[model samples]
Target: MKIFGHRGYALRYPENTLVSFQAAVDAGADGIETDVHLTRDGVLVLTHDEEISRVSSGHGLCKDMTYEELLALDFGSWKDPRFTGERIPTLDQLLDLLEDTSLILNLEVKMGFPYYPGIEEKLLEKIRARNFLSRIIFSSFNHYSVAKIKALEPAALVAPLYMEALYEPYHYAETFGAGAIHPQAGLVEKSIVDACHEKNIAVNLWTVNRTEDALKAQDLGVDAIITDCPLELITALRS
Candidate 1:
């Protein structure tokens, strides 16, 4: 099974920060998963929360603020004082960080509050311009967004995220034109893995931090295991 870093090595560094992403790259994660949100000034930025307060030393909704204002906030200090100066990075910047590497990027489009109008189109435009579509897998909690991505570009790989148990999750994913199913790690069962694999739908379990759980998922024939502790898990798997 391939190992992917969830939110870019979230356990070692602040989630979604460039430092965390770089850490994942250095740690040899096979892929890097990140949350993407559009800024008020129409820029795509990497962050997990719609409200920046949870992850940054700032206040207010991310969509309500421009990229400049968001960039000014200390995104890393909340995690550690040593990382106090780290700032939020744009999607473009993050892509540059992975340049010349073969890491797959799982870009999760966040949806909840303060909707980013035309975000899918805008995001796609940039990806195509950068010739980044091949390495990206578009995922979202909102299945519509995943469908929209397919409608926009049928060739784009999509995986809809779900925390609850879906009846025949892989079949549902197939109906949505998805190439993979991103089930929460806790909800994953070997049966589910078998079902997905039977239909050629890859199973990439998410946010699995425990080594035991990671190995268990791998044993179940998972296509990839997304984890916050990629370094340790990769080491354990290798050992």
Candidate 2:
């Protein structure tokens, strides 16, 4: 199974920062999973929440702040003194960093509350401009967004992320032309995996940091496991 670092080695470095993503690459992750939000200026930035106060020194909704306003806040200092100056990274910055690597990017479009208008089109436009559309997997809890992505680019690898257990999720994903399904790790069963595989859909579970959970995912024939500690999980799984 492919191992994807959740928010880039988030267990070690500040989540969604460039350092964390690079650390995930150095730790030998096959892919990187991150959240994306649009700034007030329409710049796509890598951050997990609409509110920046949790991860940075700034206090406010990310959508309310311009890219220039966000640059002034210390995104890394809250995590550690060593990462004090780590600024919030843009989608362009991340794509540039991953240009030479064969890592798939699971870009989760953050669009629930405080939604950004026309985010799907903007994101697709940026990826197409960068010529990086083939390596991205667009996912979101909003199934509409996933459908929008597939409609925008028929070849785009779109996945619907759901925390609740859906009845026959493979069918749900298929209805929207999704190639993959990202469900909470605890909600996955062997039957679900089998059903998904039978329909030629990939199953990628999230936040699987425990060894037992990782082992279970491997046994169930999952396509990928997203975890916060990639290095530790890689070592444990190999051993």
Candidate 3:
């Protein structure tokens, strides 16, 4: 299975930062995964939570802050003291940093409490702006977001993330017109993996941290594996 760094090699660096992303690439990840949210000014920024408190020195909702204000917050200190001044990165900055690399990108859109308004459009625009539509795949737990993207651009690769075991994943995949299905690793059974393949939909499992799980997925012929410790996972997979 293709090993993708979840939140840009989160274990080694501040999650979702450009530095972490580059670290994942340096460690030989096939791709990188990250979360995106729209600022009050409509610019797309790389982050994982609706609130900034947990990951950054800033407090309050990310949606409430302007891009400039969000940019001013220290995002790295919470992870480690050595990374004291790291700030949240813009989508453009990330793309620029990865411009010369051939690694694929998996951008996960977080499903906020009420869902961020116009976030779908803003995200699509950013991808188009970078001309990264082909290199990136959009993944989300929100079926509405996937449907909206499919409605606007049928060619876009939209993957719906599922956490619980479902009776008919293929039906749902077909319903969303998705290119793939990304289920939480534990929820994925061999049958589900086979079902997705039967429908020609790729299967990617999220947050896989154990070498045993990675090897299991690889043995099962899963298309991709999402993980936080990309360095370890890649090393283990290689060995």
| Candidate number of the best TM-score | 2
Candidate 2 residue-wise lDDT, 1-239, digit = tens: 99999999999999999999999999999999999999999999999989999999989998999999999999998989999989999999999999999999999999899888899999999999999899999999988998998998998999999999899999899998999999999888899999999998999999899989999999999999999999999999986
Q: List the residue pairs that clash in candidate 2.
A: none
Error of 2 at 134 (Å): 1.5
Please provide, for model 1 over 1-239, each residue's C-alpha lDDT reduced to its tens digit, 9 standing for 90 to 100.
99999999999899998999999999999999999998889989999988889889898988899999998999998999999989999999988988789999999998757677898999899889988999999999988888888889998999999999899888788887899999898787888888887888889988888888987888888999899999999999987
TM-score of each: 0.97, 0.98, 0.96
Looking at candidate 2, the ten consecutive residues that score lowest on lDDT are 184-193
- Ranking by lDDT, best first? 2, 1, 3
lDDT of each: 0.90, 0.94, 0.87
Worst 10 residues of 3 by lDDT: 110-119
Evaluated at residue 101, the lDDT of candidate 3 is 90
> After superposition, which runs of candidate 3 have C-alpha atoms over 4 Å from their true positions?
none
Q: Could you tell me the lDDT of residue 38 within candidate 2?
A: 93
